[model samples]
Target: MTIATLPAYPPKPRPGDRVAVVSPSAGLPEVFPRPYELGLERLRRDFGVEVVEYPTTRKMAAPEERARDLNAAFGDPSVKAVISSIGGDDQITVLPYLDRELIRAHPKPFFGMSDNTNLLAYLWSTGIVGYHGGAVMTEFGRPGAMHPLTEASLRAALFTHGEHELRPADTYRDVDRDWADPAAFAGEPPMEPGSGWTWRNADRVAEGVSWGGNVEILSWLLMADREIAPDPSVYDGCVLFLETSEDMPSALDVFGILRAMGERGLLQRFSALLWGRPKAWSLESPNSAQEKVRYANDQRAAVLRAVEAYVPSIPVVLDVDFGHTDPQLVIPYGGRIRVDGPAGRVTVTY
Candidate 1:
C-alpha cells in the first residue's frame, strides 16, 4: 500500500462571489436562528460574499436530502465554495449517497470540522482537498467578534494560495456558551489565559501530507469503512492531526482509539501527530477551572502513553489550535504541512 493520491485544491472564491451554505450534517440553524443568521450576515458584510442556502440548510432532513444538497452545491459552477452550517453525529449517514464522480468533476472548496470531518475525508479519498475548520455558525458568527487567529487563518485559506505558517494562539476558549440565550450574542464569552503548545519525542523536522481528524469521528468511520482505503499505506508519511469534541472522550477511550489505529498499521504511518487542543470543557459536563486543566493534562498523558506504545519516535505536538477550541486554525484536509520540531514551528501550504 502507498500514500493515496494528493487532492487538488479546488477553485477559491473571490470577493462578492457566491458560496453555498449547506447542512450536510445536523441542521442546527432552524433551532439557532440567531447564530445562523449572524454567520450569514458576516459572510455578506465581513467577507463580501453572498450565501445560497439549500433546502436542508436550516432543519432536520434525511441523509439522501443532505447528500442531494451537497451534490447540488458542488456541481453548480456559480457556487465558488461550500461551507457547513454546523456538524452533527449522523453526517456519516450521507456518505453512502454522495455522488463521488460529480464531486470530483466539479471540485470546490468545502469548509467544516467535527462531524464535517466525515465529508472532508470523503473529499480526500476523491482527490479533492477540503478545509478542516471554519464552519459558518461557529467561527463566522462568533458572538461579538471573531477570534483574531481564526479570522486570519480562515481568510488565508479562503483568499490566498501559498505556504502559511501556523502559530500557537496566545489564548483560547474551550467552554461553549448557551447558544439559545439571546444574551450570549451581546458580548464575548469569558476566556482564560492559555499556554502555548507542548512538544515531545524529537528535536528534528518532520514534513508530510496531512491526514486525520476528530478522533471520535475517525472511530465511527473506521467501523463503517466508508472513505478509508483498504490499504493502510495511503496514510504513510502523513502528518496526522487528531482532536476531541465536547462530548469529551475519556483518556482511556483516547488510548483505545489510537491503539486500534496502531493495530491496523495506521498509527505508525505518520511522520508526526499534531494533537489538537482538546475541548476540556463542555456545557453538558462543565468542569471547574482547576478541573479543566487537570482534564487537559490527563488527556495529554493518555496520548503519550499510546504513542510510547505504538510509535515511540513520532514527534508529537500538543495544544494546536485546530479543533473544538476558540480561535481554531484551518488545516487543509489533505494538504501538505511541515512541522519543524527543532524550531517548534508548524507551517501548512494552502
Candidate 2:
C-alpha cells in the first residue's frame, strides 16, 4: 500500500496530564516489581505526569485483553498519552486485534521501543506518528536515577513541539543488572566513555519522516508481511533508523536480515540510515569489555557489508545513542527527522 500523505504528529501531553501505562508486551512488572514500581514513582515524581495503569499493565494478559486496554487508552479523552511498561516478545499478536480506526481517530502521542516496535509500525500504517523510545519500566523507572540526556530528550518529546537536536551521549552502557535484587536500586549502572558516532558517505543532508525500530522486531514484521508497504516508493526520501535488542543477534544474522530487506527493495528506499548503538552485553552472553568492543565492531562491519551491496551511496551513522542503550533518545517515528551529514547533526520534529 502507498502512504499518500505523511503521518500526523499527535498533540503533546503536558506535565500534569494523565498518561496511560499499558502492557502490550511482556508483563515484566508482575515478575519484577521493583523496577516497575520505581518507574511509576519516577513518572509521577520526576516527570510530574499522572499515570493511569490498565488492568494488564502489571500482569500477563491475552492479546485481546491487551488490545482492549490499548484501545481504551486511546479512546479516552482524558488520557493524553500511552506508554508501554516494558518491551516483550509477542506484541505482534496484539496488533491483529487493535482497532486501527479507533486509535487513528483518538490520536495521542504513544511511547515505546524494542518489541513495542510492532505498535509503532501499526500506528504508522494508521497515519499517526509514534515515538520510538521511552518506556515506563525502563526509561522512567531507571534504578538510581534517569540519565540526564535521556530525561532531556524524553521531556522534549513529551511536552514540546518543533525540532530537537540529537547529540551523542558522553558515556553509554548496555550491561544489565539484576532487577529483582534490592541492592541494584542503590546506584546507576556503570558506563564507559563513548566513541561518538561513525558516519559513512556523509556528504549530503537527508531529511524526512523517520521509520524503523528494533531490527529483530522489524524482521518479524517483514516475515509476516504485516506493516511494510507493498510499493517501495512509499518509503522514498524517508530516514531509516534501526536498533537491536538485548537478544543480540549475531552480526551475520543482522546482515542476513538487512540482506533480505535489500532484496525486498527496502534498503534503497530510504534517504539515509541511522544505526542505534548495539547492546553489546547481556546476561545470556556476558562478554569481557574487550569482547564487547569486538562484537560491536563486527556488527558495524556487517551493516556496512549490507549497505555496500544495496544502498552504497546513502549516508549512514552508527553507534547513535538510541535503542537498548544506557542513555536512549526518543525518535519520532513517522515524524520529521533531519540528518545533516555535513554538520554531523540530527534533528527530530516532535
Candidate 3:
C-alpha cells in the first residue's frame, strides 16, 4: 500500500481578518440562541475578526446546502479562515457533495472538532492543514467567558507559526452551565486542580507529522476509507492523537478500535500516541468525581494494552488536553509534532 502525500498550502489569519463561521452539522444556534450570539460577539471583540455567515451556517438545511456553504467559504478569497459553530454526527453525509477543487483552490484555515473531523480529513486530502479545535459555540461561546487556556491556545493556533509547546491546564472544568441563563455568563466556572501528563514507556524523543482525531470519528473514517492513507508507512514515525467524545464510549469499545487499527498495520507505525482527556461524564450520565477518574484511568489502561500488544516500543502520553474537555487545546492535523518523552514535553510545529 502506498501512503497518500498531503499537499502544502498555508492559510494564516491575523487579527481583524474576515473569518467565516459555518454550521456543517446540526444548527444548535436555532436551539441555543444565547451561546450562538455570545460566540459571534467574542469573535469580533476578542479576536478582532469579522465573523461572516452563510445561508446554511445557522439553518437546519439539507446536507447538499451545507456542503455548498463550506465550498463557498473556501472559494471566497476574502474569507481568511473558516470555523464551525460546533460538531454534529451527520457531517459524513456532506462528504460526497463537497467540491474538492474549490476547497483546494482557496485552502484557508479551517477549525472544528468532533463531527467536523470529517471536514478536517477532507481538507487533509486536499493538502491543506486544518485545525482540530475551537468551535464557535463550544469553545468561544462557553456559558461563562472563554477559558483562558482555550483563548491562549487559539491565539497560538490562529496567529503563530513554528513549533509551539503544549502545556496542560492547571485546572479544568467539564460541567456545562446553562446557556439560556444570563447569570451563567457572569463568571468562569469553578475548576478542579489537575496534575500534569502521565508518560508511558519513555525511551527516545520522536518528531513527525501528526494524525488522528476523535477516536470514534476515526473509526468511522476507517470504515468509510475516506482520506486515511492505505499505506501504513505514510504514518511511519508520526504522532497519533486520539480522544473520545461526549458520547462516553466504553473502555472496551476504545480498546476494540485500537485493536482493529493494530490489525490494519497502523498501530505499529507511529512513534508516539497523545491521548486526549476522556470526557467521562455528560449531561446524560453524570458520574461522580471518583467515577470519572476511574473511567479515565480505565480507558488509558485499555489504550496501553493495545499499544503493548501491537507497538510496545512506541511512547505513549496520556491526558494531554484536547477533545470534549473544557479548555481544550487546538491540534494541527497533518502538521509536525514533537514528543520528548525524556523531558515529558510535547510540541507541535504549525
Q: For each candidate, how many residue pairs have backbone atoms clashing (under 3 Å)? A: 0, 1, 1
What candidate 2 gets wrong by more than 4 Å, as runs, is none
Tens digits of lDDT, candidate 3, 1-350: 12346546376889989999999988888878778898999999999999999998777888999999998898889999999998989998999999987887788888999999888878877788889999999999986688888898888888778777889889877766777678877887778887678888777898887888999988998998887776667778888999999899999999999999999999888989999988888888899999998999899999999998999988888888888998799999878889998888899876
Query: Which residue runs does candidate 1 get wrong by more than 4 Å?
Result: 1-4
Candidate 2 matches the true fold with a TM-score of 0.98
- Tens digit per residue, CA lDDT, model 2, 103-152: 98999999999999999999998899999889987898888889999999
How high is each candidate's TM-score? 0.98, 0.98, 0.96
Candidate-wise lDDT, in order: 0.91, 0.92, 0.86
Q: Candidate 1, residues 1-350: lDDT per residue as tens digits?
A: 12247788888999899999999999899989998999899889988998999999998999999999999999999999999989999999999999988998999989999999899999999998889999989999899899989988998998779899999988889988899999999998788787899999658889988888999999999988878878877778899999999999999999999999999889988999999998989889999888888888899999999999999998999999999999899999889999998888899988
Colliding residue pairs in candidate 3: 7-127
RMSD in order of candidates: 1.3, 0.9, 1.6
Ranking by lDDT: 2, 1, 3
Q: Order of candidates by TM-score, top first?
A: 2, 1, 3
> What ranges in model 3 sit over 4 Å off?
1-4, 7-9
Give residue 104's error in model 3 in angstroms.
1.0
Q: How far is candidate 3 from the true structure (C-alpha RMSD, Å)?
A: 1.6
